[model samples]
Target: MYRAGGTVTGERDAQPGVSRVRRLGTHLPPVARAPGEARAFVADALRSWHVPEDKACDIVLAASELVTNAFEHGSGGIALRMRFTGDCLLLEVRDSDPGDPVLHRPGPRSVRGRGLALIQALSSAWGHRRGGDGKWVWAEFQLA
Candidate 1:
């Protein structure tokens, strides 16, 4: 079973206008069902935070894409984290692999390579970075 943790706090961001941040996280096994598990985890978190259904759906989709990429291409372990501050929600997925996620533009007939593209379309901003024992691919959504 996976372990989940969270904290609701009134914190301030270093940026000029962000405040009242909340955080949630979970660790998942690298398996075929990781994407579905990620979706559930994110859905629960968003629900607990009282996020709107439409926004929650978008975040869940982004989380699923990130988790699927990690399961398919990464090694070691997988972890997901989310942060909500003011009008922004951030989703991050970390895996043992250090390779960066590539955004591909596939042709109409292509069956694959569209996960990152979908994430890009759904998220306000998205990127990846090396951290700890692996790398984290993150997507941000505007809540306001």
Candidate 2:
């Protein structure tokens, strides 16, 4: 993880395509305030990076949705990680739940079931990875 004001040039043994990387992260409490805190964290990081306002808004929204889902469906501590690759911004939320997120087609009148939909629509790419103890949901936005 890159420290504040530190730079990351990708890890050793990283793919040749990965040139630059910057990362920010925070551990979120398993409470109602997690989502809002996650959003604020993303906003601050993007602002420090000088990301454009429109793009930052989308990234912040994605972070919020991911964190909210983590708390709503997952277990244990929630952690938010944001990384700036050379060409994209990657956001990931990790939780103790081992199950993958479900994507549902909600009815028009439905008030929920749209967080993943919004992430899919706004992000350049999105996916999840499962580990022994938990899983991480992630999305990427183009930096350009």
Candidate 3:
């Protein structure tokens, strides 16, 4: 059993042209459907934020890939978080696996091992870090 939580907080200063930040997060069961669930969660959030469809699709795809990797390789629990600061959108997936994800350059006939590469191609930047409980893989997209 897992719970979902979200928080949105931001203020516009007198300097002008600053965007408010919005955030959402959830913990997901480590199951085969986790990737699909993650994609739905992200797509809903982006839609509510009025993110463009094309960009939203890319973000959702990235989230799916991260969640899939976590479900396949991680242990214990999995968590997902998203942040939108107007010009940028950030997606983070945390799992109980301490090992960092690797990006492999697969050969032409390779049947798998392209998730990280797809994420890199779709996102402006992506990385991972070890946490107290596990590790978090994050991706950032610059929105126009």
Candidate 4:
């Protein structure tokens, strides 16, 4: 006997019903503006994805880190995207940077770096990806 555990019940029989929407949302834009733009973008996206307003802070934090990393360390052009995976929201920021990102070693006096550490602490999971082109850094947190 397993419980449903925060899952939205769908149709059990042959009737068509609204299943949980594992919706995917993507955003890409020129970062020629300000810092708050990233926060605004993520907030609007979370609202669209039915994420409660109260939980916006955590999502915003994760989104900020991803976007900041892309803009700070990655290439010139950037894109921000997100999706719903199970009960969590996955956020991604892609760039054309050729540099591979690595998590800074955690130490008591560490101050020069810790972004990845922060993500790992606050988010459910996060990492980066490189393909034939460039790379993308991402993070995920519970949608609730």
Using TM-score, give the best candidate's number: 3
TM-score of 1: 0.84
Query: Lowest-lDDT window of 10 residues in candidate 3?
Result: 1-10
| Per-residue lDDT over 54-131 for candidate 1, one digit per residue giving the tens place of the 0 to 100 score | 999999999999999999998866888888874899999998888778899999999999999999999999999999
Q: Each model's C-alpha lDDT? A: 0.83, 0.80, 0.84, 0.64
Task: Compute each candidate's TM-score over C-alphas.
Answer: 0.84, 0.83, 0.85, 0.68
Please list all clashing residue pairs in model 2, or write none if there are none. Answer: none
Instruction: Report the lDDT tens digits of candidate 2 across residue range 1-144.
Output: 123222222232266874333776678777878888777677877776779999999998998899899998876878887778656888988988888888778999999999999999999999999966999999989977
Task: Sort by lDDT, best first.
Answer: 3, 1, 2, 4
Top lDDT hit? 3
Candidate 1 segments whose C-alpha is farther than 4 A from its true place? 1-21
Least lDDT summed over 10 consecutive residues: which range in candidate 1? 1-10
lDDT minimum window of 10 residues, candidate 4: 1-10
Each model's RMSD to truth, in Å?
4.8, 5.4, 4.3, 9.3
lDDT-superior candidate, 1 or 3: 3
lDDT: the better of candidates 1 and 2: 1
lDDT of 3 by residue, 1-144 (tens): 122332322334344674433777878888888888788788877887889999999999999999999999997667888888888998999998888799999999999999999999999999999988789999999997
Candidate 3 regions exceeding 4 Å error are 1-21
lDDT of 1 at 104: 93
**Model 1 clashing-pair count:** 0
